[model samples]
Target: MTRQRKTDAPRAPESPGGWDVRSEELVAEAAVSGAETAAGSGAVSGTEAPAVSGAGAGSRPTRRGAGDPVKALMHRHRELCERAVDPLEIAAGLEAHGVTDRTAARFRHRDVFALAEEMYARVPRGEEERGASMAPPSRRSPDLPAGWALFALLPGVACGLTVVGLELGGGRARFAVGLGGLLAVSVALRVALRFGPLRSPHQAAPATRAWVCFLLAYALLGDELLRAAVAGGPDEPWAPSLTAALGLSLAVAPGVWCARLFAVAARKRLALSKGLTEFSASVRPLLLGVVALYLCALWALLLAAGAVQGEPAPAGAGALGALLLLSALLSSYGFTRAPLLTLGAAGAVEAGSVASVFAARLPGCDWIAVPVEEAVQAWGPGAVPVIACGAAAAALLLHAARVLSRASAHADETP
Candidate 1:
């Protein structure tokens, strides 16, 4: 018999572009080699046959450079974030660039998701660095009284003048009291927000500074809108519309400023939540209380103005209603505990306000007949909507008070 020649097993076919060799081919070669080795030893071992099969079944052909795409995607995301690009905008850009859901799945490695999380995570340190670099050097010590304390008294001054004017001032004086007080308060708060927070105890907390900016913006936008409507004397029909439009246009600055502050606050909040930075719990309640009280007073004065005029509820009434709802909704996001409950209370008030608006607009509603004082009291049988709003407002104030008290207690406890 001719002697049989043994040869080495066949190798896997190499893929082009350095891609992984075919897994099935490698498995087949392994099985054949294992079988040959087993047969050569003696009788073919059963364990050897199953072992080869298991090896092939467990083996997977890894995609060539699977990590490269994920790394590139994460890098791009980080770049966009650093440049202050919105995540949604980044997502849109990715879609435009043909980075689809399937493309993401194609790179399905655990590291991919982890890397993506890291990519979007807030860089609080970077924010602090940017804020520090942009902030002008202290022209004076933040503690040096910048006359901002007087701005704190503006609300009380405006309120006292309003009460006195309502009780004794003539029609012209009442009008002046209403318009001038609103103007003074708005201007003072705007200036204070711009400069005050950057001074004194507030200077240390960038988040609080941002919070003040948001408050100033919100208050100014509403007040300016009201002023625009009222600036034109009641006799001048066309003037009110023009003035209103101008006011809205001018108010855009505060609106933009507020939006920017919100973004900053969100960044800071994310950093705080992630435990990447420290944030003061005590200062938040004080800031929130100041804003809540300011907004409440502004809403009250607007209501009072509408009452004094005996005219149809000014367009500003709607603004107050909107503010009420917004305040409720925003309270959840404010630096406080039990935000969900706060959200629900605000939502209830908002829903009630909507219902009232619809009810008031319905046929024969005769909202005009309701006296302004009674409406403000919101206590009569027909004043359910106003009552609900007032109650919500009261609850919000009380909650803020509770928060402030808690913060104060904590502060006293601390060194």
Candidate 2:
């Protein structure tokens, strides 16, 4: 049997976190041999990470050579790395400590994620006593502000009273009230989401932001346009469907509630979890349950709104609402790209469904819209958004379950 070489672990630097070694040279000499092999001779093989005392907590590591700058950071945050469930958790902690991508670049890393990966990999994993693995409550950042969920009711109540006012008033006054109510409800929604778990951690690009707006506009106008197309061309000016608007408006409260529930439950489960596998096992079910709860609430709201309007439930608008909520939830947790892509795709389908109607008017091009025409004829225009956004919502829910279950995703989150 070949005898294996084992090096003693590098001692940590003496920082406020109680590190002991306080020298990057010690870490460089004691770091994994694989690092030297990868970096070659020019690396920080025996170099030191000079630390200036009293630089506060956010000091940068100044080291010579090119091997690995993460070694110094790893030691400084030794407690964090050893306790982290994975690299993502470490990344969150780093970001919370004011480490940004530009700061990460000083370490020759692409971003905080890359720097975190190196640090996580360099540190040796140690087993802790049962339940001791949970991060301190302060570091285990919760996202929902106190009493934020209560704010969700404002939008729904404002819109509901507006709908009632529309019924009581007549002629020009009713039109004016309807327009004013829409603006009021819009403001309430913005305020409600601003303080809740509904706010995304990462702001989406302008284009995807427009996609969400388009989905909302489509919710009001798509049904009327599709119905008109089905009835052989537009014979009158298009009007927004109050049911669709009301359904979308009412969805805000449930979405905020569901988001708050998910955030609280996930953080609780994270604290109780002993390992990554255990956290995933417990949190995934909680995510699905929250999603189901939201769907149930939304469906009931849509049904009631439809009943009030003396029409069938706008199932399509409900689907779009579900999609929007799921996307926002995912984005709030730093999983921005997935939700943006999914929402963009759903918007494309809705836009195409409407465009196909007009495009089909050309000779020899009717086949291009055959599927949409058939779907609209058989199930009405609601079928288009129902199919599109429903699929997107399901896809997002599945992705959310997988991504949000990670202990790292919730690390350093803020209320």
Candidate 3:
């Protein structure tokens, strides 16, 4: 004769809540069955066969005292029928499982369908906390207030501009005037913003505020120097002073901005990665190189200018050097990406250089004789060397442009 097997009965709800009661009953049954199985297995020897030979018979529902299967099923049907079901109520029920008040509030703000979907996602198919083991310990500092930043920036801008002005003016009356004017303007603007109804003080770092202010001042100075350089009138003693101011401004301004920008970008990226070693490794070298190159170029220009005239060659020389350095920096940026500002500045520099050369040459009418006479008048016996320097600078600029173009093309070819 064939042996018959028994199976565990399906759960029948016998409470006010249909699925809730069923789920609880199933959980209790599973726990009780697991305990019985453990006890039975322990009582037998390792090699002994189990006495029970039914399918899920030992795993039968635990709430047998409540009712028979048919009666329990009817109770479940009655409980479900008693409720006035709605989508929102359903979502709220599910969300009550493990969600926090804040999360529930956010869900409630959404439409019914969205709330339902969110609830469904939250309940089942939930993922374990992953990527947590990979994250590094955070080392974030509290953010400084906007007011603190504004205070710090005010002093830095003032000091930087004062130093630049003093250096440019060379202790002359004109330098004092220019420096005072710049300081007054800066102070007035800051004061107005601070005390006036439009009290929106800039929230940048001190260095950043200084650089921005200096850049503005330097731009004005650059225009003046450029005009002086191209003017047909006799060279004014103050022309060199104006040029120097412009040079100093350009030299420090962009570098300050770059440092600030890079620092902010790195901080954001690091936060996203939780200061992971791999991310730091990737960004460190590039940032270091940019800062090193910029500082080195600035120092080299200063040293070279000092050597040429034996006493710093006036502010004009420094200004010119700054222009050259700025051009190179801008060109590099343009080649690597798309710096429209840099490109425009380069075009202007090139155009200005060409225009100056033509203007100088046009008056002479004869290239050889004209240059000779102009050289004699401009620098006395020393004019020849100055002329040669100008020629060399022009040549160097042209060569740089060609190299930059090739490099850009190569970069474009890269995937």
Deviation in Å, model 2, residue 109 alpha carbon: 27
Per residue, candidate 3 scores C-alpha lDDT tens digits across 37-75 of 433243312222123445533332333222222122223
Compose the digit string of candidate 2's lDDT tens values, residues 104-187: 666666667777777766664435632454545534446356778678888888889888998899989999998899899988
Quantify all predictions' global Cα lDDT against the true fold. Answer: 0.36, 0.75, 0.37
Candidate 2 is scored at a TM of 0.73
Better of 1 and 3 by TM-score: 1
User: Can you list the residue pairs that collide in candidate 2?
Assistant: 12-21, 13-22, 43-67
- TM-score ranking, best first: 2, 1, 3
TM-score of each model, in listed order: 0.31, 0.73, 0.23
What TM-score does prediction 1 earn? 0.31
lDDT of 1 by residue, 1-415 (tens): 9998866333322532222233222334334334323323433211111111332343222331212333334333445434432233333234444444444444452222232343344322355655653532211112223564444444445544554564577768867765775576566544543443211221223443343333333333433332222232223322122222222223323332332333234333323231111222433544454455444544454555445444333343334333333342233234333333433453454344334433554588747324422443453222433343355555655654444322111211011
Worst 10 residues of 1 by lDDT: 406-415
